[model samples]
Target: MPVNPPQAPTLSGDLLTIHRLLQSPTQIQRRLQTIQDLRFVADKILTARYRSSGGAVLYDVSEPIFNTREVESVAPGAEYPKDVTPEGAAALAAVSKWGQATQLTDERIKRNARPGDELDRVLRKVVNTIIRKVDSITISAVASAVTATSPAVDNWDVSTANILRDIETAEAAIEDLDMGYNPDSILMSSTKYAFMASDDKIATLRRRETTDNPIYGGDIEMLGNLKVIVAPASRLPSNDVWVFDSTQLGGMADEAEVDPGYTVGEMAVQIQSERIARRDAWEVWGRRITVPVIQEPGAAVKITGTNP
Candidate 1:
């Protein structure tokens, strides 16, 4: 009788089921998309594809004119011409890594959800970080926007304040542009939003009075024509605020779908060294991309104050 060869050890228990999670690469992508949707800033801006090195181009044309001109000496009104402008921008990507060989330890695999849960949290952190980065770009865009500062609501720490008065002033800034873009978003820091939320005017109201109004109850309140947002303080300073139309000025450019998918193999085989056993390692990696741009400068303006 011939001697039999030895067989390599294999994974068991919940690790067996985990292959189901790793096998489906699209699942990771779906989770990453969910992360993007949860991020306030990411969900609000434009998304475009990334061109290699030279960045990508966008086209812009002057607004259309209304046909309200009377003919003079058989001459038609100023004719609109075929005019288009090409603008270019670039996208940047950030990558994050998680997981380790210990996650695949024999006893650990019995309660495999532990490792899986840890990986999920790590991925969420990565995606959230990317969203914050994108928000910074938006803040920069509004930093130098047309002025609409008002002392009445200028300082958040001020003893006497009025959110409505400040908002009215900000809306005037957008309308003053006459760009036809409406102020649809009210973006602020969490700190600033908290100030508004706890204010006597918003926080204290009769139930019957607020039966038709939701802003009176929530920290993130809304006006008739504007949606209030309490963004992260790290991303947007509490000292400044903005009212703008995302469709007209804000864009997320192009972003690649994240691939938080993983692969299982041996440390020695993958790294080309006597690292460890064949099933000693696992890794979670993914990519996030974005090119946030301000298309219409006049569409968004910084309100509030610039005091020390």
Candidate 2:
């Protein structure tokens, strides 16, 4: 016969009352302040920021394409050079709602004894879950918008891989556009970073006696002209690298919260709580109303097959 574990005793008396709940809305906000300090690479990727007006559901992303410039020496009184105009396109980014919730059951509260500790733990998890969702969404938008992809001459993990040359080629693609976009940032997984850091050429440069500066010290801060950003595999593919100008790449837009008591934060995350009388439980909920808009896809170049 199979044996089942005994159930935890129900929490009653003062514990069962909504008034006795350990986490009030005020307490939730305080906890959120501490959690909000964490930095997300996605935020760094999209340097441009926007706020949606109340009751707004969509954000318009403007894409401008510049044509070749005509500069020439003119006669003394000649009319000014021909006017320059850029073909423009726009994409509608639909704001999506993302939420995560955890229920604090009566049995769980009774088992923990300290309800405050339990609530804090659950609240942190709820917020983190929502943040991950937002990060994934932002990275996905970047990948989709950057339709240009350059396959590595050789896998980055291989001994023959010319990481520096590959990066230069990728950067050249964006610069060749002549649209004034400079590829200033590189996005990749930590695994690919380690591979690049351990490559023979990089190792040789570090050992050179003539130079005091190295490509990487404690962290992979800068590689040549590009600032390195190691993204989580959950957000960026481990086998791919992205080189782009953050200034022109894209941005994030979030819907403003109009609820009487709720105010949006830098991350645009909101936390809420509800009491269940019959079940004698408290529900912790976290949500974000946001969308990532890719404004200039040409500014970014994706280098795939960086890893095995």
Candidate 3:
């Protein structure tokens, strides 16, 4: 006997059937992946990931302050370790609800007449808008928590600007803190990153070292050992850059509860859909209830005045 593979169910008939198909586990998982793919920088910078277990309006976050104490050696049979209790403070982080909604009309669905095409289109737009909002919130929180320092002389955009020296100085500042954290990554505006990549000194070095590669080819993925993260200007200021240790920087927390009709998807994002009988449309909604918390401020340094 020959067995046939099952076919994907189509969205042809009633609103109930279409809604059920859209809310299927497979389709929901696909949508969740789209959200994660869009959040490149936010996921990188926010190293610590957490989820809220209860339905709480404010998320509680606690960060331990590392004590700078050395372990003392003692004679045999003596208590060498000092009696020191771990110290930390807990603070309430306000979790903001971010969401976007889109509708799939009967006319549009009928006109397309394809299985899940119209629904996918609506989900894509709604998911993108929600991700952008979440990214903006995360970036703004980091900017506010860290202090900015202006370059002493020329900015990176200038031909004479010593970009390497500036970056080294920033790294030194973090190392001097002796907080056991060294800057491992940098975040900057795309425009500034482009300028740095095409800078005269960088190009000369790359061209001289790797002659086979084109002069204008390849992105500035790393400055020495520091990883570079290029972000949109709308999220980060064009003239600003951040040098930080991702391990000690901070974390992000999201709501974990999944409502009756809602699905708790990847990165703790919740999504729901409703059928509007009056309008003969399906309204799709996606939301993220989360907050970004800065645990160690000294682990990050912001370099400003990168351009005119």
Candidate 4:
């Protein structure tokens, strides 16, 4: 006789148990949706911090100064009648206006500009939604586990590990979730060139050694950790060398003791080069990973016209 077909797994006390097992795939999908939501929230925060808001730009103002003067002069008087006349001179006062160069001053007005309208309320709503979604997914995953013996859901329980694993797997599955686009290398290169140009101008101003002192080099090299001694080259009683970075020159040619004529083009190149280096460092260290979206579950749900 043919054996009876194996009986299907029977559901026990609560309807939630049966519905949960049937909806496992849907639960995973929801978890991924939550992750995407979190990513969006993170992007908003980054944009708010990094993106510029068009704020007020102010111009410098000039003020004028004036001076006042008084003078007294005597005129010959005929009353004396002896070819010499004594007369009281009237006091005279004069006002004159002159233009003088003065330091320009500016006051900046504080701006209350915001990146987006109602940003505070929007941010609060986004934060609350993320918290609720994360909590709901976490709680549901734990509560539906087959091995759970109590009403309370324990997220760390081994029974819930599979759900957690699925979430991890889902996150790893996405391949296009970068938070920000990579910056252009050409822009970075230009910045580095500018930095180098500026550095060369700095090198010219440095004092040259008339006689050999430990601190003096024929030409300054832009070595990273080079130092300069403040003490005069001839007066050092001991051979002590106090060193300082070339940056201490503070962009003034007089301070560096070099002749004028450091071209602007050269300084521009150095500044650009330095900027490029900084950008490169960011490109290496600040890169963000993008999570790929697995469209299978969403696709299946779409095709079937069902929640799962």
- Among the numbered candidates, top lDDT falls to 2
Candidate closer to the true structure by TM-score (higher is better), 1 or 3: 3
Scored by lDDT, model 1 comes in at: 0.50
Q: After superposition, how far is residue 150 of candidate 4 from its true place, in Å?
A: 4.5
Off by over 4 Å in 1: 1-13, 30-37, 45-54, 59-115, 144-154, 203-221, 255-279, 306-308
Cα displacement (Å) at residue 72, model 2: 4.7
Q: What are the lDDT figures for the candidates, one per model? A: 0.50, 0.74, 0.71, 0.22
Worst 10 residues of 1 by lDDT: 266-275
Model 3 agreement with the true structure over 197-228: per-residue lDDT tens digits: 77777666664656343454656677888998
TM-score of every candidate: 0.65, 0.78, 0.81, 0.13
Determine the backbone clash count of candidate 3: 0
Task: Tell how far residue 246 is off in model 2, in angstroms.
Answer: 1.3
What are the runs in model 4 whose C-alpha is more than 4 Å off?
A: 1-117, 150-308
In model 2, where do residues sit more than 4 Å from their true spots?
1-26, 36-38, 53-69, 72-84, 106-116, 206-217
Winning model by TM-score? 3
TM-score ranking from best candidate downward: 3, 2, 1, 4
- Which whole-number lDDT from 0 to 100 does residue 52 have in model 4? 13
